[model samples]
Target: MNLAVTAAAAAGAPLLSGDKGTTSEAAVGETLVSRLGDAMLGLGSRLPDMRPETLGWELSHALTDFHTCQYTSLAVRLPRLLQAGHALTSSSDSPEPALLLAQSYTLATRMLIKLDEQQLGWMAADRARQLATAANDPLAVAEAARNLAVLGRKAHWHDAALSVALDAADDPALRTAGRRGAAQRGLLIQCAAYTAARNGDRDGMRDLTAEAASIADALGGTTLLRDHGGGFGPVTVQLHLISAENSVGDPAAALAAARALSPKALPSQERRSRYYTDVATALAHRGRRDECVRALLTAEQAAPEETHARPAVKSLISGLLVSGRTTSELRGLAARSGLLT
Candidate 1:
């Protein structure tokens, strides 16, 4: 398992330029996400080859596609990756195969959640958790826990989500895993903070966010474990704070937090897109109509597939069109998102 090589390759893949794609590009991407959802849920009949020889490399490229927000590519690749991962894990006694399988499922869970496929998302997340526990890797288990917590939040089980995150953060093994442990724990805490905000516990949100920030500060400003998901560090913490503030109905505070972080400091296109989208959300909530549109446009420019294919983002675009005098750019964004065509 040459994880270093895998990480380097994934990191070096080129970012898809969001400004260059046409409406057909987004349409194709949306189709891919839909197809993948069907395939994962056994609605698709064709199965990928069971050959697991390239499992490691396949997982790396799939992860690169994921972080780059190249959903079309990822959607095309993941069915095969998941198929091969399952085959290998079932046949082999090695923990390494199980860990890889868990990671692969975790990626699928994250993508399904983004596409608003909650039913399949929950299934993938649970599978990842079971495999992670089987592999006996604390970091992998913590990541699975974070995904499950996210699904719980989406299901509106706010208290359960908070508990999942807090328990993962408190794991004795995770607490002892050193820098990697700290990074994972910080992410779990960040999750708990957002769950708190969703449940309307504003003070708890702030306190937990602060606690996560302290962990990031102790990491000395370096982002870590990006290949597993979005990296964790100070910038990521601030990004979460923006969304948390918005969730708690403080759009003004959300915008303030947004202003404090430089988008270029974010580790991946996924995080960068999230930063701009959060800014857009805050602007919209504050009734800054034009500014909100501009922020969303910036998010699309950062990662077109992420912005275009996101259900929440499309809803935001639809809301803008419903209430205001539509600008040319806003209309174009709607067309690209398949809402206007």
Candidate 2:
């Protein structure tokens, strides 16, 4: 689960494209989304011979694929990963298997949230929490709680989302897990900050965000558990601030925050893509259409599959198409994103 390695690989990874007899990126995204929806409902078939170690190996690969934002390949891998994870939990008595299974579900929940599949996301998050709690893995349980809070915010359960995040951040086990625990707590508080912004508590967002930043400062430059927290640290905290500022209708602040850090300095392509997309959103809000397109182009370059597949990106493209002066570059980008078709 060395996400740093995956992040480095992602820098040079080729984007998925359509080829003769090959699955289109669009089709892969759709199929994976559908299958994940099915899996959340316990309707998917299981794979046999899913030993605990095998599940661990597959889970590691799955997390790597996610960190790299290799969604096309991830789509191909997740079905078997989910099925095998499910199969192992039924056959194994060890808590390790359940913890692995919980992580698998957490990964699925992350993907579902990214794809805006909130209905299925809830189920996956709940399953992750249940399995993590059953395994008595406090760290995994906190991670599961983060996903649940994210899904809660998506569903507009603002107060509940904030509570979920704050409670997990306050967990005694996580409080003592050292730097890893600190990073995890920072992540949960980061989520709470965003939820606060969404709920229109601008001051609360800043206060919570500052709290996370203080933790990041305490950790200094190291990115603990890059796979788990996506490099939660000072740089990552700034990235979230960009989004949180935008969420609170401070596009200028968001753009300013974006200007403070190079996306390349971020730990993962996923985070880099997030950096630019949030910038694009802020630019779009500020009516800087040209800058917005350029920001999106940068995001697409960082992780094409992730950039093109996100509904938020598609909506930004769609909005751009119907407003302002049209350009060949914008049209081409829109067509590639499947919004023009």
Candidate 3:
């Protein structure tokens, strides 16, 4: 995934503008925490009552901001979404508000994780799971499980991540036939593939990604999802495969997989930037210094604020500097990205 920054960036750098949308990861976390805290402290009355339809519309926009890595906008909107969601979930007897609340919490979990706040992200993930379970919606439950698995993986709990991903995928609730089922099943395997990579289970990564690929092919290029918000479909599967290969230290295979896909085909700027970053990582590992720099530059263009905030990108820059080219161009790139700091 790709990201921007908030007023409070994860890595102690202020956000820089990109040609594409970019925002602050720091602000995203701080804002969510503060806003949620206020709501919990009985500030709910300060916010206007929102209908389910209005809340849903705002949620869609917030999700669009999320997919595009617009964290500054998210910082403004997400807190309000949470408040409105809480209000709706409490006032309305309908299950829609509850499901919407779960989805909003899941979105919060994603944002917090990206900002490297895993412990705090846990709250959002668990809240999502609780709401989803209470709603008894299979799709909501599946999405919540996926978010929980992501939080687990981020926290380096590989075994637990893999178990939850597989269990969520195999839950009878997800066994129904057709497109949604296929998407959920494919997504779980992708998460499992990610866990396998983190656990250094190379063969499992390969097998799980292959299964996901087969499911994608079965969908006949239908693109089961049109946005990263859904987090499924053929494009995401390819991205996950590349990430798994890279995580397993197979840079050559990672680059090969990256080359097989087109960034333009990705639905959001965040994923496109992530594709470039993955390519940069693979190139860096191969000592293809010039190409690595080029790929990172491409990533920055896609999302400058995000590129700097990523741990992997920071590590790659440090590695490149250690290898000691020391050219003016390289130095300039490093300075602009705040890698020199």
The TM-scores of all predictions, comma-separated, are 0.89, 0.91, 0.85
What is the overall TM-score of model 3 with all chains considered together? 0.85
Candidate 2 C-alpha lDDT tens digits along 1-341: 00011100011122223221234443345656766666555674454667788878877888888888887777656766777777777887888888888888889988899887888888888998999999998888999999999999988999999999999999999988888888899999999999999999999999999999999998887566733747588888899899999889899999999899888788788888999999988988888889889988998888888876777677777778776687998988877776665
Off by over 4 Å in 1: 1-23, 28-30, 38-53
Per-residue lDDT value at 172 in model 2: 99
For residues 71-179, write the lDDT of model 3, one tens digit per residue: 6676667777888888889998888898888888888777777766676678888888899888887777787788789888887899999899989989887787457
Better of 1 and 3 by lDDT: 1
- Alpha carbon lDDT of residue 91, candidate 3? 91
Name the candidate, 2 or 3, with the larger lDDT value: 2
Top TM-score model? 2
Error of 2 at 130 (Å): 0.5
Candidate 1, run of 10 with poorest lDDT: 1-10
